[model samples]
Target: MAALKTSTTWIKGQEFESEHDGNKINVDGDKKNGHGPKALLLSGLAGCSGIDVVDILHKMKVEFSDFSIDVEADQTEEHPKVFKDIQVTYRLKTATDNLEKVKKAINLSLDKYCGVSAMLKKNSAINYTVEILN
Candidate 1:
């Protein structure tokens, strides 16, 4: 297996600049400094799943507009806090008839394709809902 690599540089006051491959991201332990680490994880989850969903939907010939994924996770209150539960809402502006197909696409990503989901699910409970807007 090939190794994935990243490096982080300190930027003072609970802030860091992380580089993956060639892309750089600002991460912070404090919200005022940059994006919180956990929140960035949530974004990664959404992005990973979203990519799968879009590709799956295209192959399924599902046309949609205003596609969005909203993620909310609850974290533990103790030290070394972790996510207890995560909820993902998938919103699609498409025909109601396409709801079933959209759901199928999401299920495929969450259950079989998304690596991030697979990793996160090992520790946190994940649930999802679909909303169709005409």
Candidate 2:
């Protein structure tokens, strides 16, 4: 089995530094120094799926520009709050004829390729929308 490891160290109150494969990020629960952990998870989901979609689109010969993803989640009110649902919006400038191809890439990413999406879906309902721009 392939294993990936990361390390997180406490920096100060509500602040921590996490490192993986020589990359590092600061996570702060207070949101004063860095992004909160929950927010980072949402980013991870977007990044994972985005990478897959880009690769799939490239393989399909679909050209696109200004591609971006916006992710939002509704969190439960209870302690140990968790995401109840997530909304992912994909926007890009591409040929109108490529719409179906883009959608297919995104679907394949979320449904089959994105490990982060697979894990997040265990607890949160994930919804996605695609917008094509000129």
Task: List TM-scores for all candidates, in order.
Answer: 0.95, 0.97
Off by over 4 Å in 2: none
Candidate 2 lDDT, 55-89, residue by residue in tens: 99999989899999999999999988999999999
The residue pairs found clashing in candidate 1 are none
User: lDDT of each model, Cα atoms only?
Assistant: 0.94, 0.95
Candidate with best lDDT:
2
- Candidate 1 lDDT by residue in tens digits, 9-108: 9999999999998999999988886789999999989999999999999999999989999999999999789999999999989999998999999999
Error in Å for residue 88 of model 1: 0.3
The predictions' CA RMSDs to the true structure, in order, are 1.0, 0.8
TM-score of 2: 0.97
